[model samples]
Target: MTQPRIVLYSALLCPFAHRARIALKASGAVYETVEIDLKNKPAWYAPNINPASKVPAISYGAPPDSDVTKPPAGTFLLPESALVVQFIASLYPQIDYKDPIIRAKASFAQLQWDNLVAGRWRKYQFEGSEQDLEPLLEGLKQFSDSVPEEILGDEYGVADIILGPFVTRLFIFANEDIGKWAPGSGPKLVSALSGPEYDKLRKLGAKLDKWPALQETIDNDILVKKFTEILKNH
Candidate 1:
């Protein structure tokens, strides 16, 4: 059997792209990464790869040197972050996609996390309005409180893969350098959310702490450095 080749176009800071990259890593499938310049996107992504011009697009095939057009048999471009993660998870079913029920549960968990980030957490980042982040913090608090211990498994799964990027972003935004991005009520927002529930999430992620592969992905300071370089070039 020919080794399946997976190519990922991604940016380090992008949570969406982060999902695809981490999912691919967790799947233990060999893949090549093409770090996209999100500030100035390449032309190939506009029409062929992703019409929306998103950062993360997975192509399974040879590199620029090869002639193969189509990807490996049974392979297709998975675009959206949530879908991309699910697709990679499905590829290596033996790892975590053990049974139908587990698969469904994991999918549900992924969607829930997506919703929480999109609806609540993102508002604090993108929206620079009154800067009253109490609502946002409360929403995340609810999210953490709702999760039970059973879900935070000993082995890594979609639960950690989906949340890691956003969690890291939140931590960075709360830190000294990036804290200004939050402004007026951001400190309160961070304080409120970084509670017992937040600890639970961290505890869940503890298994990831020792894993070099996972650490390499969520290295927040490294991402800050990368983003700094990107900003300069732009």
Candidate 2:
């Protein structure tokens, strides 16, 4: 079976876009990458590609060099990182979610992370709270506890691709004790998340670090510096 021509419009710093890159690399798909500058986007990007002007967009069934901006009608233009990653997985099932059980676990993990963990993660980092890290920590504990058995086991599926990058950042922030949170908050978060209770989550981040896609897609030191910039502005 031949893979469709794919051009990934991505940004290195965006966690959402990072999921697409991980999926692409894990699937071994041959695709051209057009790195997008989120700050200074291309003039052609919004109208020609994603009207929302977001990274991790995909233009399929279009020539990689066609018109540079005007992707012809009928090109399957896809936006949003979760959908994009699933689309790639659908195209190459062998690489991800090939088993129904794996799919179920992925869905479960996604829900738990979004409902329990995601929002608190943002709040803890970008806004000051007397609660400090408690909100984020509690959310993480529940998220970890709710995951299905073997979710962090031998298989790497959609859950890992979608959530791993952000989780990795959390680990880094906690270890370095950096961010908009209180000065010592970083080490506190890391210490708790690293305890045996969160071992599965730790394993997930470890795998992300060891993955081939992650070698270039994720840089810990760079991300720490990047988040420093973001949190300072808040």
Candidate 3:
């Protein structure tokens, strides 16, 4: 089958967009990226690209009478990072949910982690107070044990793609003593993950460090500095 022309609308600092970036790279899909300025989104983006005016929106497939310079009138535009990641995963057999039973299991597993684990971690990173450390610690501990060795056993799959960006950020924030990143939780989470209790999570961290696509994204010094500046201002 001929592959569709894919164009990704993305922002460098968005964690959600980072998910799409990782999936697109891992899938080995040929795609173009249109970097959007979240602060001042382009005039033509809304209603035409993504109604939500969000980054990580994708323009996919070619129209019946496709024009080389423009997406087809029938080009499919999809928004939301999770759905986009799932769509890309569904396209590539090597990294997708191949069987119905496994697909169902993976979906449920990812949903559980999203609700019970990733959501809490996000809260701790953004809105957590000093008083929130204990619960956050407990949550991280449980999450470490709960995350599968690789979201899909041996290969990086949808679950891993969805969680990879956030995990990379967590590892960065936890390890660095960024004075104001997260008052108590940041350092404490680092100490906890480094300790014997989170051996499994430490191993996962090691695996992430070695993941080529993720490492490439994480190693973008400019983007890292940009995000760090945002954190400093926060």
Best candidate (score: lDDT)? 2
lDDT for position 217 in model 1 = 70
lDDT by residue for model 1 (2-100), tens:
656788878877888987877887777888777778878776665656678896888765444542233434455667887777778677764454556
Position 109, candidate 2: lDDT: 78
TM-score per prediction, in order, is: 0.77, 0.91, 0.83
RMSD of 2: 1.9
Give candidate 1's error at residue 162 in angstroms.
1.4
Order the candidate numbers by TM-score, best to worst.
Answer: 2, 3, 1
What is residue 72's positional error in candidate 2, in angstroms? 1.6
Q: Model 3 residue 166 lDDT?
A: 71
Error of 2 at 115 (Å): 1.0
Put down candidate 2 lDDT per residue, 40-129, tens digits, no spaces: 999999999999999889988886558646789989899999999989988878667667886787788788899988888877766646
In candidate 2, the residue pairs with backbone N, CA or C atoms under 3 Å apart (3 or more residues apart, or in different chains) clash, namely: 177-186
Q: Cα miss at 178, model 2 (Å)?
A: 2.8
lDDT of each: 0.64, 0.80, 0.72
